[model samples]
Target: MKTIIRNVHKSFGDTKVLHDISLEIEDHEFVVLIGPSGCGKTTLLKIVAGFIPPTDGIVEMDNHVVATSSKSVPPNKRNLSMVFQNFALWPHYDVRKQLLFPLNHHRYISKEIRGSKKERIDEVLEMVGLSEYKHRYPHELSGGQKQRVALARAIAAQPGLMLMDEPLSSLDAHLKQEIRNEIKKISLNVKSSFLYVTHDQSEALSLADKIVVMNKGRIEQVGTPEEIYNFPENPFVARFVGKHNLLNGMWHDDVFVVDGVRWRKDNVSEAFKQKGMIPLRPDELKIVGRGFGNGSGAGLGDGFGGSVEGLPGVINSVYFQGNQYELNVDTKYGELKLFEPLGKWQVGDKVLVGQR
Candidate 1:
């Protein structure tokens, strides 16, 4: 059930959308395509779903060329299912009928699965936590329930690959979090390859086994969730994938000099050094007590209690983020952003910004 996309490019009139996009989805792997709007993530998903053909390159499914520039095997023939942002369910059918349609009609459904359509529907409904809502129609279901039905229908066919295009975008924040957990569990239990598309960094980070970071019609980086979040390959990935403040610095061997303070470059990618920049995550920063000389060699500490030699900055704004406080500080170098647990910090408070 491995899918390979090779040199795929898409264009409309003279406007190019995707550029030499190449990716691979392994069996039972959850791969997420993530980028900002107009970054060609959706266009790439559409090409793989057979809704549109690539202008150049081929898509292979298990060694079989399913799509090429000249032609494409239609979506139905490709043995894959897609779930869209708008829960594309039939208005006339109840939840049970929605699941039964694919199980009885899909080409990929095996005889064993098709013969036991009633049991499969029950199993799928239970899997999506919609077992109690099987008798309800689209209008009778909430947005979350409607999406569960969509998910159930997609899986009822037992397709080898599932393509999802921002399926959780329309739901509210609380519902989004709830369904996201369900999606993760289902993706694992079903053992189906999932190629999901979304712009939300949290969803990508939480749901993906491998993340494909795309920007401006090109792939920025591809790695596991930990690798992509910690060791970004480029400036675009560093800024887009996580909450990082890019710092201008000079790398001297393994030590990085920024704002008159030298720090060791621990596990930072080489791209930062080449670009004369470093990415500092919020957790990597700390608020220090205002004392000591500006360029003293006092190393950064856990917080205001230890060493105080660091970049002098004034707190600009503070945001309460549940368990932590996100602070924006204005410094001589630039504005620095960092997070701290509930503290007595307020706007216009003078503090020294340091790295942990």
Candidate 2:
């Protein structure tokens, strides 16, 4: 199904929440809406699901208007399925009953179909790798298993579009990773359009064919994972999507200067002149042993060579992050965080920071 949202706005009392939000979900594409809490991602999803009417604009499915400012098609009639953060399973019903509940309620299977309801239930259970636990109740399964049942229930409905809201937030790290992969595979096998909502950047980056980053109830940027991460449209996206060391400086004569240090600037537009924030990822900056041109002869000689120069800073703190050490250094501008792959540096150590 192709979903289109155009100029959708929502407000409650006097507070405005979504602002002229427009996006399109292509057929069988997995699109993710990502933002912080209270950013109106869920509100937008609900609008698409026909749970509420928008304050303005319209939503369409396959070029057919399903919702507008005054009217909306009921959620059940939209031929779409939803999986919520909570499993929303029936505690009294067993796994088979839960999986068959949607199919039975909607009368999706006809009498002329070759397979019975139990057979169809078993098929979805096997798809989710929960066939052995078909007879188990909700209380009998683990958290991950219960979530799998929720996903299975939604899939069994055979909706053209599926909406998921943070379906794996409750699981542990390992289980979250496992289910994320499962969701990717399931989407491929089902060949249905998926509209997912989450605040986790990693999930959006890993799962989405297209990512929509939201902030303050507005669509900040929309692009593929690589485009959004590498070329953020603005400062908020640059700061929110990944770990970055933002440096405030002035652009002058094709150079960006900060704290008496100069770096060559490239591809900056003319609109940015007096001041702007330069975002540098962790890998872009490195720590060196000696200051640039200080002549102290205290160089670390870790293959940095002479291509890169150093910026002066003192180590503020050090954190052990398994493979590498995350060091917070206090520079003239502000506190900058960088990753150190080797060597041990203590707090209050005056070190030279450089860009690779």
Candidate 3:
């Protein structure tokens, strides 16, 4: 059940889409391909799924060549199941028929197995919590329910590999989160190798066993969620994966100087030093009172009550993020985004920004 993609490249006329992309998905592992729009995540997925042939590369499943530059195995021939962004269920078929269609027509299922199709369908429907809606049509179900049906249908096929292309994108925010969890649970329960594609980093972080971050048709980095978020390999990945306050600066004499303001550098990699960009997450930066002395400015208690050590800045704007206040501060180098617990500071108020 291991899948390997080696030196995969794709081009459309004069435009090149994928560039030397290579990755491996282990058995039963959940791997997510995430990046901005048109970054070739979907293109690479199609290549592995046998929908298209790579210009120069080989895609192997368990040492068998499924696709290569010379030829490609057809999609239906591959023992793979795909769940699309749009619930690609038949409009005329009920949930039961939709779940049973694949089993009825699949060549892999023998006559002996065909007799248990109803039991298998029941098991999958129960896995996705759609047993009660087995008789309903696609139009009669809600967005989440339809997605669950789609998932149940895919699981019922019991393919070794599951390819999900933005399967939860069409749902609303709450439903998206709910279905995202369901997808994770289903993957764990079914133990199928999942290659999911999405632009949402949150989905990647929350769902994937390994995340492949792509940019401009090339992979930027691949690692666990903590590694991608805490120690990004490049500037693009640092900014793309999370809410980062990027400070453009030069590093010399073991110090980072930005707009004539110097700060002691820590937790920065040597590679990032060459790139001249420092990324600090939103939770890393904190807000304190304006003045140095007690009672001289807003008498904010605790950390803000005493003298704070940080770079000087003015609050430019404040945005409410439900749990915390996101403050956009105008610093000497550039604008920095930080979060605060209280919304007491107004625009144009001078403040100090420090890392936690």
Candidate 4:
């Protein structure tokens, strides 16, 4: 199911939850909606599920208007199933009963259809690795089991599209990773498009084929995980996607100046359309020989001088971060952070700074 959201807008009184959200979800593409808590990722997901009507714009799927001025469809009629974070399930029913319960009440289900439903149930239960626990009651299952049951139920519906709202957030770290793998497996079996909502950047980066980053109820940037992480569109995106050194500088005659230091803009990527603004990644910067790169070769020009080495400043802190050591150095440009290979620097080491 390819979903097209055209100029979608939704509001409650004067508070707008989604504003002019227009997106194209390609067929069978897993798209993840990611942002901070109040960024309206979930609201947009619900509207796509047909739980709420947009105040304006059209929600269309496969060339049919699901939401428009003339008509608005309800949840069940939309043929879309969802897996929620809370694992909504019936406590009174056993696992087998729970998976088959939806089919029994389905208005279109016939006796023969009900008999054939067991094949689908068996397939999904095996997919979730819960085939042996078919008769287990909901209370007997662990958190992960309960979620598996919920996933089994959604898959049994055989929806054309699946919407998951942080389904793994409630699990422990190991369980989370396990379920993430299963999500990929089940999604492949269903061959349905997925609309996933999550605040975890790693989850979005790892799971999504396309990532939609929203901020303040508006779409900020949409791209693949690599695109968003590497080639950010603006200062906001650059800061949001990863760790960045955002320094105030003026571009004068093709050179960028931060504090008293002059750096050639060529070494760093000049991304912003507006000139005189420089944003740098930590890896792009290097600590150089004190008098090497700086134009002035005076005694002061050991090279490019900064707190990392040549310049004198106290080491604020140092911590080991797995593959690298994060160094917080108080520098002339301002407080600067440098990442070096583990065991490279002790608590207090003098170093020079420059960009290559």
Best by the lDDT measure = 1
lDDT (0 to 1) per candidate: 0.88, 0.83, 0.84, 0.76
- Give the alpha carbon lDDT tens digit for every residue of 72-109 in model 3: 99988887888989989999999999989879765445
lDDT of 1 by residue, 147-258 (tens): 9999999998889899998999999999999999999999989857999999999999999999999999999999999999999998899889877888787998877787
> Candidate 3 overall Cα lDDT vs. reference?
0.84
Instruction: Kindly list the per-residue Cα lDDT of model 2 for residues 255-327, writing each as its tens digit.
Output: 7776656666565433334346676767678785543332322233434565434566788799998889999
lDDT of 4 by residue, 1-356 (tens): 78899998888889988889999988889999988898889988888888778888999887888896456887777757789899998899888888897676643334654778888778779999999999998889999999999988876766667889999999998999899989887777676788999988778888888999898999988999988776666676666665565666677766766555666644344556364566666675555542233232113434335333233333568888899877776665565566767665655665555454
Model 3 regions more than 4 Å off = 107-115, 250-267, 291-306
Best by TM-score: 1
- Candidates in order, TM-scores: namely 0.95, 0.89, 0.91, 0.81
lDDT of 4: 0.76
TM-score of decoy 4 = 0.81
> What's the ranking of the predictions by lDDT, best on top?
1, 3, 2, 4
- When 2 and 3 are scored with TM-score, the better candidate is 3
Once model 4 is optimally superposed onto the true structure by TM-score, how far is the C-alpha of residue 25 displaced, in angstroms?
1.1
Candidate 1 Cα lDDT to native: 0.88
